[model samples]
Target: GVTAITAVSPAISARQEDTAVAVANVVMFGTLAMLAYPYLAHHILAADSHRIGMFLGLAVHDTSQAIGSALTYSNVYSDEVVLKVAAITKLSRNLCLAAVVPWLTYLNVRAETKDDEGKEEELEGKKSAGGKSVLAYVPPFVAGVCAMAVL
Candidate 1:
């Protein structure tokens, strides 16, 4: 959820209202996941610390929430493996953000640009004037993300 908001916000070309609603949904669902994951791990996934950890790491929307859920589960069940596994899994998932964010941003920008182009063609009967280059559509933060991923 935090990744969605932080990584996607700058690349989003949607109206502020739409972005706000999306952010709100992310936060709401993430909160719910944080609250519910521990109990689900305990009852539904009994005696499987690794599965519980993987489920929490993959299912939770935020890194902190995943780790917190694992910690809560650990304390409740008196098992420390869940915490270790969850942290590793969550951090591994987080590393993908560098690649995923830029790709998602590019796709979003391309889709919006295509829609705009089609609309302009219908109205003007020609290619849009002063159209942005492909390079221009690339988000600025992509380079930094790639650099950090390399490091």
Candidate 2:
């Protein structure tokens, strides 16, 4: 997963750990995303019995994990509904990447201006076009992310 991120996020080339941090954050988010799924599912599916999809989708970061977990759930407690729910919910969580990039871009813009001490550090390499306006170079990946957002 980290290997694949290099192609999408050119900024990751500046620091290898960026890739690790990005992937790890999303995977961890996937785990956390499941936190409310059970409660919601119990209320929504109070009469219906299938919930494997909710569990698999909430816990999984990748399709393989979703499929594997759903398969296991199927053998133990669920049916075809497990696969359907898992696919939809996992995909919903995965789409967060589209939203996350915009927020990171906002933080990046903010960081260019101030630091932890609230002092405006001298920018070493890329100077601002004007003393007042901060310049931003939005990468092609962001265009794709925007397109995903539009969809």
TM-score per model over all chains: 0.71, 0.51
Provide the lowest-lDDT 10-residue window in model 2: 128-137
**lDDT per residue, candidate 1, 49-132, as tens digits?**
999988888898778888888888899889999999988888777777666765665566555545544652221332223354
Judge candidate 1 at residue 63 and give its lDDT.
81
Residue 92 accuracy (lDDT) in model 1: 77
The candidate that wins on lDDT is: 1
| Model 2 C-alpha lDDT per residue in residues 1-59, reported as the tens digit of each score | 23235434542224667777887876666445444444444456662534547666766
lDDT of each: 0.72, 0.55
Per-model clash counts, in order, read: 0, 0
Most accurate candidate by TM-score: 1
Give me the runs in candidate 2 sitting further than 4 Å from their true place.
Answer: 1-14, 21-50, 75-78, 115-151
RMSD of model 1, in Å? 5.0
